[model samples]
Target chain A: MSEERKPGEPANEISRRAFLAALTTSAVTATAAALSPLKDVVDLPTLEEFLRLHYKELTPEDKKAILERIAAQVEKDYGVRPNVTDPPPIPGVEFGYALNIGRCIGCRKCVYACAKENNQSRNPQIQYIRVLQMRKGSIDVESAKTDYEGEVPKDGFYYMPVQCHQCRKAPCVKACPVQATWQEPDGIVVIDYNWCIGCRYCMAACPYGARRFNFEKPEIPKDELNPEMGYLSNRPRPKGVVEKCHFCLHRTRKGKYPACVEVCPTGSRKFGNLLDPDSEIANIIKTKRVYVLKEEVGTLPRFYYYFNL
Target chain B: MTLDRDEGSKRIPLAAAGAAVACLLALAVVFTKDLIGKGPGRDDIPKLSPEYADPSTVRKVRTEMTFDGAPCQACHEGAEPLQGNPHEKGIFHEHIELKHGRNQHCFNCHHRMQPADFSNFDGSPIKLDNIQLLCAKCHGTIYRDWGLGIHGRRSGFWDTAKGPLKTQVCIACHNPHWPIFKPLKAAPPPHINPRTRAKGGKTAGAENHGGLD
Candidate 1:
């Protein structure tokens, strides 16, 4: 072997072997760069390209191809086939929700359930709704609003919940750079997981402050996964994409009440179709004093509340 | 000599301008705080009747509002129409949809929740100090129940001197969407003796009471 230099000494000259080693490293790096997805190999797809397609803009062939890749990757990473499906919509069902503010206990079990069902990314947790506590006689939403200091429901405080309005004229749709989120024939808005670029423009544009961005891949236990599939709702969401409420299109389209509405103990929520005069929701709105969260914005929300005071 | 006059004139004007600017800045801070710290959908004011909370009992107010075509899906996990509404104009939220639609994040709404006294509904003052009205905005159903003595833990004191105790809002004991209220029968209309003889069908407790009103 060649003699080694002192620990602190610098090498004045290199042998042919040393020179060859340096050449080897440089050649390896160049080759790797040439083979990278970003290189002129148009056939290979970069993660960014895969994430940029909007669900609406995707052709049937594109969606199939993406799904196939996702399936193969799922097997490679987890050794099991991901249950992917586009469930049929429930027939003859018009959806509405009535939150019983008086009966909500704020245990947050529903929040956890949603994250699991939606296949949300694992990094930072995301909850589609927030329950805030406010003081009486005070219109101050901030005083009892969450992320505030002090205990909940202070001596004279009450809770308020805020969520996506699902506006009839959604601003987020206007703000999307890619057509990842678009309205369906059924009036439901959906996002193509493969098409989202994580640009986040829609989130800022939404006046209701709705929308969430995934930062990491979702981690879920197979046991907890809702075996009953929903292609849109509980069908695991992907990372580096955006997602929001799809009205449980999978189940509601299948003719059922939302999980929260069914589970509410006080019959606080009243959900139904607005079209039928005979529907419970329509009757409640027609007979009682009802209101929408905001009308000036002209979002034309599907949700309505009745006050029987 | 002319230069000295010019300096003096400019100094006076500059000082006056600075004072005016300071006052204006102070006023802006005070005025803007009200709109800068409120919950979403809630605005600078909280007047429910400003337009629709209550009108003549006979005149019907529209309630089945539709936002089906809006940008709500960005954050909402569920919004797919479950079925054809009887009217076919609106869609229903199914159990799974409702489960996924739980609101637990701030950005979901209140994109801008400022502090102010200009609140809507119940004419609640739009100040951070008065947020109960905020909860009452969408949760009016529970608010009404709270007002009728149906919510909150009751105190054991039996003093009659106090008039009606303030009933807490729906937020006091339960959540709006994901509630845990167990169903129970209403306390059998205060065990009335059927024959107390209202003489003419007054109130139900009319006959059994020897106690003074």
Candidate 2:
């Protein structure tokens, strides 16, 4: 049986060719493996992570398992065990935000508060909120200086802080080819880090530039990681994923206002249930000359801006 | 002799292959080690508990007219009526520069008889805490707006069922003396994005927000 040959070619020659072929393949593989950039030996995902299901497709058991795996990983890596869970959207609720441009003093208290609340990466400065300093009597966001570090509320400038509007018709959701992002029933746009391919198409599609891509692994200090994380919100994200404000669903779902809304000293920020007629935001929309950013684009953003007459 | 030479030549590729495999295995080991010790550190970070706004703690909008802790009566009771130009710096009150529009006379809001408290047009004394009532006499719409959480800033649970809604007093943002919001120091703007960095001024493209557009 060992000596038998099926082809016209000599069996000895064929066997020699096969040996050479196997050696070459192994050699190539070895060389490629050696040449690969193995930065931080622990960069490879564990088996469970590699096979994790998409957020939308996850079954209850899958979610539980995946969540546990993530928690264990977080504990192992950060030394602090986190409860990474997703609370379902509340019944009879739709979140809305409003900014009173008249009263916003341009102090970035809300900005720092958000960064701390969400455990944003600090070294490279990934801020979810960009408070644009626009010239008075102007609405042009393009010319609005977001990086102005000078004294705020400049004589001719008004501050307008922008974040994810959590649009009812979110362009980010539409831009995600893999369906990794979507608008929740409560009008919050969320991303599943594990599912995101980091194509950055959503970043490009967003007119407001709300989405942020993790260019490198987020370097949150050990004690700074917010242990209370939501599955689709502030759970510690890995490198190569897109993240943005989820209206602080982790806190909001638990009957808390977003950190930004809470920390606003001037009370310029407002958040409430859009479905509730008596909510503050509802009243503003009903009576005040409220406007949405880029309304012509028809994004139907839940965020509103109103001037005090 | 020829066979010996062929065997010696074959050792080179074999040796090279051996070295390559060894290097790959070494890399795999190093990656594993890095994961165990160097990845997400065990260093402790101060954990921040999720914060919820409590409406009960919110302060009512009020003005800080006097920095002097003494009751208004302590200084104004026996003091002679402010005689010189009321607008000029007074001997007793060095810092009271009245900048509020039109109603600059001290007697306008302050009760002339009971100088300790604010007053309405009817000359009835209004408690310092109830100053909003006096302001409402002039700005009815603003009062209504404040009551509805539309005119001023507030913090706390939006859903009353969940928690109370806190709000700022009128004086929280505007100085009663000045009654005007002065320019404030703005926070640092966002870092320049690659696109914005490449282009000179525009954040995105040909988009304008000014009413001029």
Candidate 3:
């Protein structure tokens, strides 16, 4: 091969070294062009954020510093200082939610209440709860309409609000390549927004379509910003991260009812610590004809739908 | 071995420089703490005060004169008290359209003598404060569910140890005269994404009908 090359190639023929150099130059140019859009980013993470350890690795002191940094960033952006907390899951308290399909008025109050409490975006609105107006005597979710207008609890229709089930064996957690999302000890699945890589594998893997991806910077109005935020739950998520209902962990950890449960006019939504045998949720499961969404998947979802009529 | 030792010795200064840089960043975080100005703590955030609907007050608002100043005895004094469906065309309670199924008697719920109090199944007078006893006569199952905090609206803390759970009375949500729930105006549905609009305007979950038995 060396002897053949020594017989000098024609001037038009390309040498291996020139071809290799050209390929390298083109690759470098393409990479630079791809990264050029990053120059316009105004909210780039500081050195501390870039070097910060994962959520599980952070000490109490490290967490406090990080919270302070986040709070400062929020105050700068929205002009309202937020109380950001990393509330730990309560021991021996697996949360469960039950909804009375018979009692639901299809009012969608819980949906709006969740959005307001969770700081979900207003424009291109992100609601965690989707109240399906299902036809009476039919459990078909595909035929259920979400955009039904006028006064609700319409004749021959029942409403079923769907949100994160916080399954015991969550598919979203398994699909996460980076392990950014995981189920807490309390059976509430949460996501570390900072660690999410925007691949949206979890979104596609979710059977309930419970996961929502932030395609743009979340646009919450200044006055409407929920000052109380949970780090793994409702804190203002950055662009390009997946978010879903976390059972309002910030409030639930503190023993308050979830915003949806509180705002439900028909008393359709029920929530309680499942471990407590005497709790309302436990009693409902034991007494009522409870049905889990997609129960065939064997996800063992904490959210249940039942009829009391 | 000598070359490897030389390389190791060269890398030590680089490692030291990296450590120094990390220490400087830690120092910067510590120094900038005051500049961040101590954002609100969990306690600093305002607590959301839950509103509990008072059943008696709601009933008073609904009846307008039943509990405010006019008592039933004011008109029935020394006269024969009208019984069995007081919702006559010219009667005082003509506005109360009694649509409650199978419950068509006035004395069945309301005390015949006292008029202000409710009647238990045994005809014992149940005060307005104990209205659940009156409701429990016919709605035994619902009363049982309500006692377990499943049938009615409960606000405030889920954990009774942490805070009080205010369970709404049946009368707060349902009118005793006409116990059926009226339909309510629903809040708006979610805004549809433009991208979804571009794809023939199908909302999420509208297409997924698989595996549902």
Candidate 4:
């Protein structure tokens, strides 16, 4: 092939051009070969989706466009079109959650209710609430058993369900290398799932162990997908992001009680505005000596625990 | 002689300056200790909205709400309520289980003269809508807590001006006859954890979701 070079051109020049051409061709082939290995991974996110700006940085128009794209993508993937929206926080409202440790019967009704309300995955089972069956006279979460299959409200055990406390001084928010997770004005610690880089630093930073990472694509039944979704709340998240309880912002922001709070047969769960003087949580904090979990750590979790007695 | 006199004057001022510096340092140390000892100052506890009851529960219970099947006037209109256990005859009151504290007779909760309504602490006819008053006769503390909107769950808007707030009535959750709630089936426990994957376990499916019982 070298000997068959065209006549009338400088032999050295022709050889140099051929060498350069071969180098360029090989470089192209090598680049293609490298990208071929990532074909499965790179196929999901479009270039526009991958280059999307952070949630905070998005303009109204940008947000609308991004949301539409995401909704379209979700519809395509899950076979359901979710109303993924970011609703404004209610004015003069600051959310607070309380649990009556005395009344909790260890029935995980709140857990399943939360999963169903938040549109969580069923097969892989991403549950936001974990009912810790702790022994009486002990508040140590480290020793609390979560896998107890026996009759609940067991002889010596009391149930304490733990979820995202939505701390005022959220360590998870501070730990996010990317500003993906943040606290809303209503005191809900929310995650912009699309913006999370999946560093798992926030998971390590959380003292309550409230955060859950999507190890694989969250799998939900087609009919189970909640059509009502808050943009920063229960919107179906992609693989490799962190998720947690958002005080059911999707429902609560719309002037509705959280599903968990409504389903609680014993009325152990309490939620209201911390700023409001007569709110149920505030009354509990005022009248009942409400204590927070891991208070020495000073995370200032909005979740309070109290014995009605 | 002039230079020696200047040095002598400088010595007094330098000693005075040293004393002042020491005093300032002592003040700073004392203030720092005082601040540290005090810790985070009392944060202004925010005032909550006045309406604290569960909006949904309160909304669901109408003031004139009647219990299913049996009306208060059904027996109280013509016949005198039978004394002692209504179920002692074992005819119509088979479901009546007096699990409430200490009371044995039918008239403990019911008025002797007026069998149509419950009795209050003042022995007045307590309407069914104001059952809290009837419960308050014994459970004063719980009644107080309920009044403050903490003992029971509240639903609806925290801002009452925005929407109606509903509180769960005493009978909504507690059975008047039994008083104590029966334990229903709890939701499934979490099967997966941070360390479970290391042990090679999978998520609990439908077969393993419910309790062992």
Best by TM-score: 3
Ten residues in a row with the worst lDDT in model 2 chain B?
A: B204-213
- Report lDDT per candidate: 0.46, 0.73, 0.77, 0.72
**Share of real contacts kept by model 3?**
0.34
Tens digits of per-residue lDDT for model 4 on B49-124? 1121112331234455233567656655625546665546547665678788788766788776666577776777
Who wins the DockQ comparison? 2
lDDT of 2 by residue, A1-309 (tens): 233334564323324344455566666665555545564356677787787767777899998988898898889989999988888999999999999998786777777678777878654456788777788987987677655555556777788888899988888999999999998889899998888999999988898878888877787888777898888888888888999999999889877788888777667888888898888888889988888898999899999998886
Q: Which should have the higher lDDT, number 1 or number 3?
A: 3
Error of 2 at A143 (Å): 3.1
Query: Poorest 10 consecutive residues of model 1 chain B by lDDT?
Result: B47-56
Encode model 4's per-residue lDDT on A156-218: one tens digit a residue: 888899899999999999999989998888889899887888998998898887888886677
On residues A1-309, what C-alpha lDDT tens digit does candidate 3 reach at each position?
122333444444444444444445555554554555567798687899889888899999999998898899899999999999999998889999999999988877777778888998766467788888777887888777778877878989888888999999999999999989999999999999999999999988888989888877888888878999989988898999999999999999999999888877778889998999999999999899999999998888999999995
Candidate 4 chain B weakest lDDT stretch, 10 residues: B45-54
What does the lDDT read for residue B8 in candidate 4? 20
| Ranking of candidates on DockQ, top first | 2, 3, 4, 1
State what share of the real interface contacts each candidate retains: 0.00, 0.33, 0.34, 0.24
Quote model 4's TM-score for chain B.
0.55
Off by over 4 Å in 4: A1-38, B1-90, B193-213
TM-score of candidate 4 relative to the true fold:
0.75
